[model samples]
Target: MDNEFYNAFASPISVTQNALLKNETGTTQKPPKLMDIDDYNGWSERFGNWVEAYHLDAWDHTEVQYFRPLGSDRKPIPIRELSDEEKKKYKNEKLMVSLLQ
Candidate 1:
Protein backbone atom coordinates (compact mmCIF):
# COMPACT_ATOMS: atom_id res chain seq x y z
CA MET A 1 0.00 0.00 0.00
CA ASP A 2 1.14 3.51 -0.78
CA ASN A 3 1.58 5.34 2.50
CA GLU A 4 1.38 8.68 0.71
CA PHE A 5 -1.91 7.78 -0.90
CA TYR A 6 -3.26 6.42 2.37
CA ASN A 7 -2.13 9.43 4.42
CA ALA A 8 -3.51 11.88 1.91
CA PHE A 9 -6.98 11.02 3.14
CA ALA A 10 -6.10 10.30 6.75
CA SER A 11 -5.85 12.42 9.86
CA PRO A 12 -2.49 13.90 10.94
CA ILE A 13 -2.09 11.44 13.83
CA SER A 14 -2.69 8.62 11.36
CA VAL A 15 0.70 9.23 9.79
CA THR A 16 2.68 9.34 13.01
CA GLN A 17 0.88 6.43 14.69
CA ASN A 18 1.06 4.29 11.56
CA ALA A 19 4.77 5.01 11.26
CA LEU A 20 5.20 3.94 14.87
CA LEU A 21 3.17 0.79 14.35
CA LYS A 22 5.38 -0.14 11.41
CA ASN A 23 8.48 0.34 13.51
CA GLU A 24 7.16 -1.36 16.64
CA THR A 25 5.50 -4.71 17.28
CA GLY A 26 2.53 -3.82 15.03
CA THR A 27 0.19 -5.43 17.54
CA THR A 28 -2.66 -3.75 19.42
CA GLN A 29 -4.72 -4.77 22.41
CA LYS A 30 -8.39 -5.59 21.87
CA PRO A 31 -10.89 -3.21 23.42
CA PRO A 32 -12.73 -4.21 26.57
CA LYS A 33 -16.37 -5.12 25.92
CA LEU A 34 -19.06 -2.97 27.53
CA MET A 35 -21.68 -5.13 29.21
CA ASP A 36 -23.88 -2.37 30.56
CA ILE A 37 -24.07 1.20 31.85
CA ASP A 38 -22.41 0.14 35.06
CA ASP A 39 -19.25 -0.76 33.17
CA TYR A 40 -19.23 2.42 31.09
CA ASN A 41 -16.48 4.31 32.92
CA GLY A 42 -13.88 1.56 33.04
CA TRP A 43 -14.80 0.11 29.66
CA SER A 44 -14.68 3.55 28.05
CA GLU A 45 -11.21 4.31 29.37
CA ARG A 46 -9.77 0.96 28.36
CA PHE A 47 -11.47 1.00 24.98
CA GLY A 48 -10.25 4.54 24.34
CA ASN A 49 -6.69 3.49 25.11
CA TRP A 50 -6.99 0.46 22.85
CA VAL A 51 -8.28 2.50 19.93
CA GLU A 52 -5.66 5.18 20.51
CA ALA A 53 -2.89 2.61 20.46
CA TYR A 54 -3.98 1.61 16.96
CA HIS A 55 -4.74 5.21 15.87
CA LEU A 56 -8.37 4.23 15.33
CA ASP A 57 -9.30 7.23 17.48
CA ALA A 58 -8.75 9.35 14.39
CA TRP A 59 -12.23 8.30 13.37
CA ASP A 60 -13.67 10.08 16.38
CA HIS A 61 -12.22 13.43 15.28
CA THR A 62 -12.66 13.14 11.54
CA GLU A 63 -15.60 12.51 9.27
CA VAL A 64 -15.50 9.36 7.17
CA GLN A 65 -13.70 10.00 3.90
CA TYR A 66 -15.23 8.09 1.02
CA PHE A 67 -12.75 7.10 -1.63
CA ARG A 68 -12.81 9.23 -4.76
CA PRO A 69 -10.73 8.20 -7.74
CA LEU A 70 -8.87 10.89 -9.61
CA GLY A 71 -8.89 11.15 -13.39
CA SER A 72 -5.84 11.87 -15.52
CA ASP A 73 -6.74 15.55 -15.45
CA ARG A 74 -6.51 15.44 -11.62
CA LYS A 75 -10.20 15.96 -10.97
CA PRO A 76 -12.25 13.41 -9.08
CA ILE A 77 -13.72 10.63 -11.18
CA PRO A 78 -17.35 9.78 -10.67
CA ILE A 79 -18.00 6.98 -8.19
CA ARG A 80 -20.29 5.24 -10.69
CA GLU A 81 -17.41 4.86 -13.17
CA LEU A 82 -14.75 3.35 -10.89
CA SER A 83 -12.25 0.94 -12.39
CA ASP A 84 -11.51 -2.39 -10.69
CA GLU A 85 -8.43 -0.89 -9.00
CA GLU A 86 -10.42 2.07 -7.78
CA LYS A 87 -13.02 -0.28 -6.34
CA LYS A 88 -10.28 -2.05 -4.45
CA LYS A 89 -9.02 1.23 -3.09
CA TYR A 90 -12.54 2.08 -2.00
CA LYS A 91 -12.72 -1.14 -0.04
CA ASN A 92 -9.72 0.03 1.99
CA GLU A 93 -11.94 2.67 3.57
CA LYS A 94 -14.44 -0.04 4.51
CA LEU A 95 -11.65 -2.03 6.13
CA MET A 96 -10.76 0.93 8.35
CA VAL A 97 -14.38 1.23 9.45
CA SER A 98 -14.52 -2.46 10.29
CA LEU A 99 -11.40 -2.11 12.43
CA LEU A 100 -12.94 0.70 14.45
CA GLN A 101 -16.18 -1.19 14.91
Candidate 2:
Protein backbone atom coordinates (compact mmCIF):
# COMPACT_ATOMS: atom_id res chain seq x y z
CA MET A 1 0.00 0.00 0.00
CA ASP A 2 2.74 2.48 0.99
CA ASN A 3 4.91 1.45 -2.01
CA GLU A 4 2.03 2.11 -4.43
CA PHE A 5 1.37 5.56 -2.94
CA TYR A 6 5.07 6.39 -3.05
CA ASN A 7 5.37 5.33 -6.68
CA ALA A 8 2.29 7.28 -7.77
CA PHE A 9 3.68 10.48 -6.23
CA ALA A 10 7.29 9.90 -7.40
CA SER A 11 6.29 9.19 -11.01
CA PRO A 12 4.79 12.64 -11.60
CA ILE A 13 7.70 14.34 -9.85
CA SER A 14 10.18 12.50 -12.08
CA VAL A 15 8.26 13.50 -15.20
CA THR A 16 8.20 17.13 -14.08
CA GLN A 17 11.92 17.01 -13.37
CA ASN A 18 12.66 15.54 -16.81
CA ALA A 19 10.62 18.27 -18.52
CA LEU A 20 12.22 21.03 -16.47
CA LEU A 21 15.72 19.74 -17.23
CA LYS A 22 14.88 19.15 -20.91
CA ASN A 23 16.02 15.56 -20.66
CA GLU A 24 13.01 13.63 -21.83
CA THR A 25 14.39 10.43 -23.35
CA GLY A 26 17.27 11.98 -25.31
CA THR A 27 14.89 13.99 -27.57
CA THR A 28 16.07 17.36 -28.78
CA GLN A 29 13.74 20.35 -28.46
CA LYS A 30 14.07 23.55 -30.49
CA PRO A 31 12.05 26.75 -30.54
CA PRO A 32 9.74 27.23 -33.54
CA LYS A 33 10.86 30.85 -34.14
CA LEU A 34 14.41 29.67 -34.88
CA MET A 35 13.40 29.07 -38.52
CA ASP A 36 13.76 31.98 -40.96
CA ILE A 37 12.19 32.75 -44.33
CA ASP A 38 14.63 30.59 -46.27
CA ASP A 39 13.95 27.59 -44.10
CA TYR A 40 10.22 28.06 -44.47
CA ASN A 41 10.54 28.40 -48.24
CA GLY A 42 12.66 25.28 -48.48
CA TRP A 43 10.25 23.23 -46.44
CA SER A 44 7.33 24.59 -48.38
CA GLU A 45 8.97 23.63 -51.63
CA ARG A 46 9.62 20.12 -50.47
CA PHE A 47 6.07 19.78 -49.15
CA GLY A 48 4.68 21.10 -52.42
CA ASN A 49 6.69 18.54 -54.33
CA TRP A 50 5.31 15.76 -52.22
CA VAL A 51 1.82 17.07 -52.61
CA GLU A 52 2.24 17.35 -56.34
CA ALA A 53 3.41 13.78 -56.59
CA TYR A 54 0.85 12.25 -54.26
CA HIS A 55 -2.12 14.64 -54.03
CA LEU A 56 -2.22 15.73 -57.66
CA ASP A 57 -5.35 13.83 -58.49
CA ALA A 58 -7.48 16.38 -56.66
CA TRP A 59 -5.83 19.63 -57.76
CA ASP A 60 -8.77 21.20 -59.55
CA HIS A 61 -9.30 24.91 -58.93
CA THR A 62 -12.60 25.36 -60.76
CA GLU A 63 -14.70 23.27 -58.39
CA VAL A 64 -14.49 24.77 -54.92
CA GLN A 65 -16.08 21.72 -53.31
CA TYR A 66 -13.00 19.65 -54.09
CA PHE A 67 -10.43 21.89 -52.38
CA ARG A 68 -12.81 23.59 -49.93
CA PRO A 69 -10.42 26.46 -49.28
CA LEU A 70 -11.76 29.94 -48.63
CA GLY A 71 -10.49 33.44 -49.32
CA SER A 72 -10.45 36.37 -46.87
CA ASP A 73 -14.16 36.80 -47.37
CA ARG A 74 -14.87 33.11 -46.68
CA LYS A 75 -15.68 32.56 -50.35
CA PRO A 76 -14.04 30.16 -52.72
CA ILE A 77 -11.77 31.79 -55.31
CA PRO A 78 -10.34 30.29 -58.45
CA ILE A 79 -6.68 29.30 -58.13
CA ARG A 80 -5.19 31.49 -60.82
CA GLU A 81 -1.75 32.97 -61.14
CA LEU A 82 -1.33 35.75 -58.63
CA SER A 83 -0.73 39.24 -59.99
CA ASP A 84 2.32 41.31 -59.05
CA GLU A 85 0.43 42.94 -56.21
CA GLU A 86 -0.87 39.62 -54.91
CA LYS A 87 2.56 38.05 -55.27
CA LYS A 88 3.95 40.84 -53.12
CA LYS A 89 1.87 39.57 -50.25
CA TYR A 90 3.87 36.32 -50.29
CA LYS A 91 7.24 37.72 -51.24
CA ASN A 92 9.28 35.40 -49.06
CA GLU A 93 7.17 32.32 -49.65
CA LYS A 94 8.12 29.56 -52.09
CA LEU A 95 6.32 26.52 -53.49
CA MET A 96 2.85 27.90 -53.12
CA VAL A 97 -0.07 26.25 -54.94
CA SER A 98 1.10 23.81 -57.56
CA LEU A 99 0.88 25.29 -61.05
CA LEU A 100 -2.06 23.61 -62.74
CA GLN A 101 -3.73 23.97 -66.05
Predicted model with the maximum lDDT: 1
- Model 1: residue 62 alpha-carbon error in angstroms: 5.9
lDDT digits (tens) for residues 3-74 of candidate 1: 878867786888777765443332454444565678678766765566566655344433556648689999
Candidate 2, residue 9: lDDT: 67
Give the range of the ten consecutive residues with the poorest summed lDDT in model 2: 25-34
Highest TM-score against the true fold, candidate: 1
Clashes of each: 0, 0
Backbone clash total for model 2 is 0
Off by over 4 Å in 2: 1-38, 59-101
Looking at model 2, the pairs that clash are none
Which lDDT tens digits does candidate 2 get at residues 3-100?
Answer: 99888768888778766544212222221121345666654564445444544433322222233346788885444655554443333222223232
